[model samples]
Structure formats: C-alpha cells, structure tokens
Target: MVPIDTPTLGDRSYLAHDGSVALVVDPQRDIDRVLALADEAGVRIAHVFETHIHNDYLTGGLALAEATGAAYHVNAADEVSYARTPISDGDVVEVSPSLRVRAIATPGHTFTHLSYALESVSDDGIEAVGVFTGGSLLFGATGRPDLLGHEHTSDLVHHQFSSAHRLADELPEHTHVLPTHGFGSFCSAGSTGDTTASTIGAEKRQNPALTQDEEKWVADTLAGLDAYPAYYAHMAPGNSTGPSAPDLSTPESADKETLATRIASGEWVVDLRTRTAFAAGHVTGTLNFGVDGQFATYLGWIIPWGTPLTLLGESPEQVAEAQRELVRIGIDHLEGAATGSPQDWTDAPLGSFERAVFADLAQVRHHREVSVLDVRRTSEFDEAHISGAVNVPLHELLDRVDEVPSGEVWVHCAGGYRASIAASVLAARGVHVVAVDDSFDEGAKPSGLPIAAA
Candidate 1:
C-alpha cells in the first residue's frame, strides 16, 4: 500500500494492490499523480473507491477510473449524476485471488459515507489487513460533523461517535487504521497529533471518538471546529456532477497594464511570491497569498467564489503549482498570469511594507501608537492573544477591513503566513502596515509582550 498525501489540504489518497492490480481510495482531482504511481509500480488500476463524496476537494475517482477504464465505486445512496458501480454496506468486491474489499457503513462525515475493509485471502484463510476510514475515523480525531450544515450537525456528530465505536468494535485490534482525513485537513474535529500510522488498538486507546462518551465527544468536537474554507460549498456539487480534467496549461500571460486593469476591475490579482519578497516590493493592489504557505486554503477562504483570478508568480513553476492547488478546490480556471519580479511586471513604483518580528512590535508599541491586528481565528484569539489587538480573522479580513482602526496597523497571526496576507490587504488600501514575520509561540510569547485571554 502506498499513501499519496496532499499535505496542504491535509488529506490522503491510498493505492493498494496485490502485485498485479491496484485499488485507489479518495484520490485528489489531479489524476496524473495516481497514474504515475500505478505505472511506476507496474500495476493496472482496476478499481477506484470513494469513502464519500468529499467536502474538501473534488474527487479524482471518477476521472481516474475513466482514464484507466476501472470500475468506479461510490455509495448507492449518493445522488450523483454520473453512472457508477453502486456500493453499500456489507457488499464485498473481490479484486484478485489475493485481494478483496468489504464495504462497512460508517456515515459520519457525510450521510452516506462508507469505509472499505481490506481482506487478504490466503491458504490459511481470509484475514483483515486494514480499513480505509475516510473521514469517519482519523488519526487521533474524527471528521467534523458540521460540513453538511448546522441542521445535520447534531445528528451527524452522534452518528460520528457511533460510527467510530463501530469500527473499533468490529475491526481487529491489529488491523491498520488508514484514514483519509486528519493529517491537517479542516475535516478533522480535533488535533491529529504528528503520527503517520496507527492501528485500531492504538486508536481505541488514543482517539477522542473511541475514548470519550458520545455526548462529551459530540460537544467537544463541535466546540473545537473553526470556520472551514468558503470554497467547500462548491466541492460536493462539483464532485457529484463529475468534473472533467483540469486545464493546467499555462494561463494567458498578463502584462503590467492588464494586471493593473484586472485589479482595478475588482478581480483578484494574487501575488504568489514569498511573503518577505512580496513585502519587499509588489505591484500595488495585488493581494499576497504566498504559494509557499497554505496558499489555496486561505485564498479560497477569502476570495469571493467565481471571481476572476490572475496569479503573479516569480516563475512559471510557481504559477503552475498555485494553479494545481486552486484546481483541487474546484477553482478550475485562471484569468491570466504574470511571472518574474515586480520590476518585470511594472515600471511604476511598487508597493512595499515592513516585515518585523514580535520584538520589533513590542519596541514599536513602547514608542508610538499603532493598531495591532490579530488575524487568526476567533477561537485561536480567544485562547490567548496580545492584549488590545483587534481580532479580525484572515478569512473575514477583506469584508471587515473597515473595522480595523485607522493609523499604522501592525498585523500578526499565530505564525507569519496569515499576517502577510492581512498586511497585503491593508497595504493595498494604502493603510500603513507591518507584518510580524515570526512565530507567535516562539517569538510573541517570549518577546515580553502582554498576553491576555478572552
């Protein structure tokens, strides 16, 4: 078994085979990665399985199955428009003489979610290998139950608790617990810790879903969830209707004037450079969503859906990487792109901002009046934050930019990523701003600044 990880989005797709034929689970929209892995392993992809219609990313299962001429397996209850080999609880698929998969009803992440348990058929008799607990059972957590909407959260969370216990009770302790979410995906209801692999025995001892009572687990899980990306609203619909392969070909190159025009016309002209490099010099009005740092998640969270987007990267590769991230979230197309330095993009004087540390913020605070903006989520801010800092999260910053008080605004997130994004938004509006480009725990807490809890 080989796990294909999408760390930025905190999800995994698995490819398991019996030396000749392979079955894939929860593939991302880019099918090329899966195809390459299969070809390198000298195996044919015979089956594609989805634990559920994903809410985080458009599934590549249908596209990959179509490309490989494989059988596509999805829940029989899903109201998808595409034709698929309908699977339900208790149904078993014999992939080869050595490999077979049994579907187990584990609806928690979604109403019709199913987990597939791999069984190895041997001369000694059939033995279970592991179960693909997509969003139902994660590393140390379970999938968040709120993605379906507030109306279903209560029932689904209860269902999530029951589903997790069911897996722990039914699967053998030695059976591997391979899950699709919890690596870093927002689908996780709590922390997944840092482990790479786990077994049912380990999960039963450590996972919140397995250790806590259903009532407490449901309450804690719901309380721990912060806002997920706005683009999530589009993922299920895109997956259900069957999305085609993304057009990853380089977008039409935009000149300086075109980029300016797009920015002026209320389009998102994003700068995909390093936050430090972006702060040094960038075209005025271009928002910074550095490709190096959770680019798609924050960008997709903030950008108005279906708005025309143009990327400004330092290279063609950067632009392409950003394009790939966008496509996974169902942002299929880019308006245009421009690669190279700010100088290459524009002859006009570029916008610039100060990139400081927590110490600098403290020093500046002592000397002059400045508005300190904390751009982390409200839950994060409430846990602890620098005293007197205005709490407008990065996702809500654009809409609430006016709420940020006038004068020099110094912004910081837990780390520096979201701070740069917030700084860019402020700088674009001609607000004097500085990005605290250092770790909060490693910098802010130790920098002798006053920390307070809400």
Candidate 2:
C-alpha cells in the first residue's frame, strides 16, 4: 500500500491489491512521481478514487483516468461535472479476479464523502483486507464537519460520528487504514501526533475526538479548526457541480509572452516549481506554491476565496494540477490559461507575492515595529506559538481586528495560507496587512509581538 507520509516529496501514493488489480485513492496533483513509480512497477492503475470533491489540491483522478484509462470513482451522492461512476455504501466494485471494493458513505466532511473497503482475494473479492479512509478516518484524527456549511452541523456531526464508530466497531481490528490527507492538509481536523498513515486500531486508541461522543466531536472540531479560509465557501458550491476539467494531456510549456499576458490581466499566477527553482528566477510577482508538497492547501489560502486564478507553472501538467488544486478548494471560476509572457496581456496587471519561509521573518522583529498575527486554530496557539504574536485565527480575524492596535500588521500561519487569508480579511476591511510564514511551531509564542491567544 502507498503511504502518505513517506520519504517521497509527494502527498501520498497507495497501490492496493486484492491479488489481481490496483486501486489508487485521492491522487493529488503530484502524480508524476507516482505515475513514474507505476511505470516501474509495470502495473496499470485500475481505479482512481476520490473520497470527496476535494478542497485541497485538485484531484489527479481525472488526469490519472485520462492517462491510464482508469474508472473515475466518487460517492454516489457527490455532484461533480466530470464523468464518473456513482459509488455508495455497500456497493461492491470488482477490480480483478481476486481484488474487490465496497463503498461506505462517510459524509460530514462533504455531503457526498465515501470510504472504500479493499478486500483480498478469496471466493470472489470477499475478505476486506483494509480500508482507504478518504479523509473520513485518520490515525489520530477525523475529517472536519463544517465543509457542507453548518446549517445542520448537528446532523453532520452524527453522520461523521456514525462513520467513525462504524469503522471502529465493524472493521476488522487488523484492517489497514490509509487516509487521503495527513499532517499538513486542512482536511484532517488536527495532526494526530505528526503522522500520515495509522492503523484503525491505533486511531481508536489514541484519537480523542474519535472516542468522544458526537456532541464533543463537533464541539472540539469546530473549536480547534483554523478559521475557515475565505475560499472554503467559494470552492464548495462550485466543486459540487462545476464544469468538466480541461484536459492537458502531453502538456505544453507556457512561453514568456503568454506568462506576461496572464500576469497583466489581473490573474493571480501561482508557480508550482520547487522552492529552489522558484527562488533562482521567475516572473517577478508570481506566488510560489510548489506542486509536490502542500500546493493545494496553501494555494487555497493565499488566492482569496473567489478571486479569478491562473497558473504560471513550469509545464503543462503543472498548470493542469494547479487548476485542479484550485478547484478542489472551490475556486472554480477559472479564467483560461496562457503559455507566454505577461506582456502578452495589456488589459489587466496581475500582481505577485513572495514565498515566506522560516527565514526572512526576523525583519519585522528586528525593527520591533511590526504586528504579528497568527492564523492557526485556538488549540494550536494553546499548544505553542511565536514569542510575541497574537492568535486571531483566520475565521475570526475580520470580526476580531478591532481588538488589534491598528498598525502594520504582519500575519503568518504554520506555513502562510491561513496567514494570507487573515491578511486578506484585514485588507478587505481597509487594514494594512502583510502575510508572513513562521511555520506553525515557531509562530506560536507570545512575547513583545502583538499576537493574541489564551
């Protein structure tokens, strides 16, 4: 089975076998690595499954399907524009002579969320060997309940609770658990002790939220979740029933002229190349959210929820993955992409934002004249924080800014997406803001920095 937190730079890759075929779960935009591995293994990907209409990176399922001709699978209840077969709880799909899959409705993370049980070969795909928990269940965590909007949070909580409890009580104790998202993903409620893959048994023992009753589960999740990125709402409705994804098979490289036009036309250009590659030289102003790592989640944070987005990547697949990743977070009002320079477009002038790493942060502290705002959840602040920062998670930043002293506010998060959203919230309200990246651990402390928390 392909694990999420491997030595590889990619999100996660799993190849499950019932002895005859392979099933791939939630292949994020970083597919080249896995595709190459697939080639080496000499195995054809039989099924590409997405647990939900993702909100992190765009689903590579569509591209993987196009590339390998695998059947694209999603929960029957989910609505996406792409062509896919409906998968539901208790429905068994035969992948090979020995391997088979049974779908389980694991909603609450999303309305149409699902989990699949992979069974080993027997009389005919009978014994479930393990379950690929598509953001439904994790080693030390579970999926968030607010994705569908909290109108019926109470009900969604029960749905999620039921799903988790079912896994705990029904699934075999030895059944392997592979979750689609792990530590850095906004999908998981929280890091369950810095891990990506964990067993169902291990989760049942350690995950406090999983063991809690439904009431506590919902409360803890809502309380600890980082403020909902502004993009959350925007991406959900669009992804629910959006347009078919553009096919970028045998991708074409964008030229300097096309790149210039894209930047000028007021589109946010995201460079999905490696950080070192990005830092070496790039079109000035392009935001650097790398592809192989946490692109989907971070990109959703910086680009504002409903802003028109365009990609300025190194290759055609990079561009397509960027587009898909944006859509996963519900940013589907996509404008067409160009393959040339920014000067190609004279109508609009798109701006750029620099990559903020663990370094370059002391500038504000050195001056002792900048305000630091932390955009992680309240629990994260309680766990740790930067020496002198405030904890105004992105969700409350808009309403809570009145508490700040009103100065040059420099916002930051574990990386920078939430901080970017927090900064955007302040900017939209006529506040001067600069989003920073202090990682999450280093930014959790409260010193002279004007950060907020308990």
Candidate 3:
C-alpha cells in the first residue's frame, strides 16, 4: 500500500496493489500523481474505489477511471448522478489473482459510506491485510457527522457510533487501519493524535471512539467538532452531481490594464506571495492569502462562492501550485494569473502595512489607541486571548467587518496566518491595521499583555 498525502487538505489517498494489478481509494482531483505512481510501480490500475461521497475535496475517480480504463466503484446507496459500478455490503472485487477487496457498509461519516478491506487471497484461504476506513474510523477519533448539516447531526452520530463498533468487532485484530481523514483534516471530530497508520488491534485498545460507550462517544464527538471551511458546503453536491474534470492548463497572463479592470469590477485578486513580501508591497486593493500558509482554506473561507478570481504570484511555479490547491476545494473560476513583483504587474503605488511581534503590539497598546482583534476560532478565543481583543474568527471577518471599531486594529491569531488574513481584510476595507505576525502564546505572557481566561 502506498499513501498519497495532500498536505493542503490534510487527507490521504491510497494505492493498493499486488504485483501487476492495483486499485486507488479516495483520490483527490489531481489524478496525475496517482497515474505517475502506477506507472512507476509497473502496475495496471484496474479499479477506483470511493469509500464515500466526499464532502471535503473533489475526488479524481471519474477522471482517473476515464484515463486508466478502470471501473469506478461507488456505494449503491448514494444516488450519485454519474456512471459507476454500484457496490454494496459484502461485495468482493477481485483485482488480481492474489489481491481481493471487499466492500463493507460503514455508514458513519455519510449515510452511504463504505470501507474496503483488502485481502491476500491464496489457494488456501483469504487473509485480511488492511482496510481503508476513510472517515468512519481514524487513528484516534472517527469522522465528524455534522457535515451533513445540523438536521442529520443526531442521526449520523448514532450511525457513526454503530459503524465504529462494527468495524472493530468484524475486522481481524491484525488488519492494518488506514483512514482518509484525521491528519489535520477538519472533517475529523478533532485532532486524532499524530500517527496516521495503526492496526484494528491498536485502535480497539486505544481509539476513543471504539473504546467509549455509545452515548459518551456521541456526546464527546459532537462536542469536539470545530468550524470547518465554508467551501465544504459545495463539495457533497458537486460529488453527487459528478464534478467535471479539472483543467490544469496554465492560467492566462493578465496584463496590468486587465488586472486593474477586474479589480475595479469587484473580482477577487489574491496575492500568493509571501506574507512578509505582501505586507511590504502589493497591488492596492488585492487580498493577501500567501501560498506559504493554509492558502486554499483561508481563501475559500473569505472569497464569495463562484467569484471570478485572478492570481498574482512571484513565479509561474507558485501560480501553478496555488491553482492546484484552489481546484481541490472546487474554486476553479481562475480568470487569469500574473507572475512578478507588484511593480512589474501594476503601475499603482504599492501598499504596505506594519508587522509587529506581541511585544511591539503590547507597547503600541500602552502608548496609543488600538483595537486588538483576535482572528482565531471562537473555541480558541474562549480558551484564552488578550484581555481587550475582540474575537472575530478569520472565516467570519468578511461579514463582521462592521463589528470592528474604526481605529488602528492590531490583529493576531494563534500564529500569524489568520492574522495576516484579517489584516488584509481590514486593509481592503480602508481600516488602519497592524498585523501582529507573532505567536499568541508569547503575546499572552504576563510580561507582554494582559491575558484573559474564559
């Protein structure tokens, strides 16, 4: 088994093969990497299996199947409006003479979710090797059930509880557990330790979802859920309706005049340069969602759905990378791209902002009037924050801009990424802003600023 890790989405796709034949599970929209891996391994990809209709990233199943002449396998229960070989519980698929995969209806993360158990089938019998649990079970926690919307939350949680125990009870103790979510993925109920690979034996002994009583498990899982990116709402429908293949052609270069016109017409002009570089100089009205940080998540959170966007990057490679990340979240309306410094791309005078450490912010607060805005999540803010800071999560800042009083707003998140986002939003709104590009822990020190505990 080979794991394909997409760090941007914090998800994993797996290629399981036995010598000449292989199958891909939960692949991302970019199918090139999976193709390359299969080519390198000298194996034919005969099938693509989706454990569930993903609500996080666009799956490359259809495109991959089209390219490889492989059959796409989806759960029969999910009414996906696309061509696929509908699989049901207990259905066994033979990939090769030695490799066999069985679909087990998990039905936790989604109502129609399936977990595939790969086994080595010899003349003697079959031995289970690994199971791709997808979002049903993770290293420490199970997939959160709230993504189906609030109405299904209670029912899904109940299903999740039953599904987790079923996997534990049915799978062999030695079977390897591989999950698609929970490696920094927002789809997870919470952080599931750090390790990504484990066995059913290990999980049964240590996984909270498997060990806790059903009621406690449901309560804890529900309580631990955090706010996910706004773009997630579009994924389920896109997957159900069958997402179109991604067009990875190089984005056309937008000349200075066209860029300016688009900016004037209220198009999203995202600067994919470094945050420090963005702060030093940028096109006047552009928002900085630097590629160096959680670029796609923050950009998707703030940008309106279906907004035509253009990219400004330091190089062609940066623009290409940013485009790939954007496509994963279904943000594909990239109108054009420009690669150069701010001056090379535009004739307008460059904009700049002050970047401060926590100590600098503390001194500024002591000396002059400043509104400290904490752009971390409400949970993070409730745990602890600066005494006078107004909590406006980065995801909610665009709509709640008026809540921030007019003044020099000193913005900070746990680190600086969200703070940079908040600063850019405030700057675009013509609010005086000082982005505190420093650690919140250092800022909350007794020697620095007054810390408020919730």
lDDT of 3 by residue, 170-219 (tens): 88999999999978788888678779679999999988878888888888
- The number of clashing residue pairs in each candidate reads 0, 48, 0
Error of 2 at 37 (Å): 3.8
**Which candidate gets the maximum lDDT versus the true structure?**
1
TM-score of each: 0.99, 0.69, 0.97
Better of 1 and 3 by lDDT: 1
lDDT of 2 at 277: 51
Give the least accurate 10-residue stretch of model 2, judged by summed lDDT.
4-13
Q: List all candidate RMSDs to the true structure.
A: 0.9, 6.2, 1.4
Q: Give residue 272's lDDT in candidate 2 (0 to 100).
A: 63
lDDT of 1 at 166: 91
Q: Give the TM-score of candidate 3.
A: 0.97
Across 280-299, the per-residue lDDT of candidate 2 in tens digits comes to 44455465566666566556
lDDT of 3: 0.89
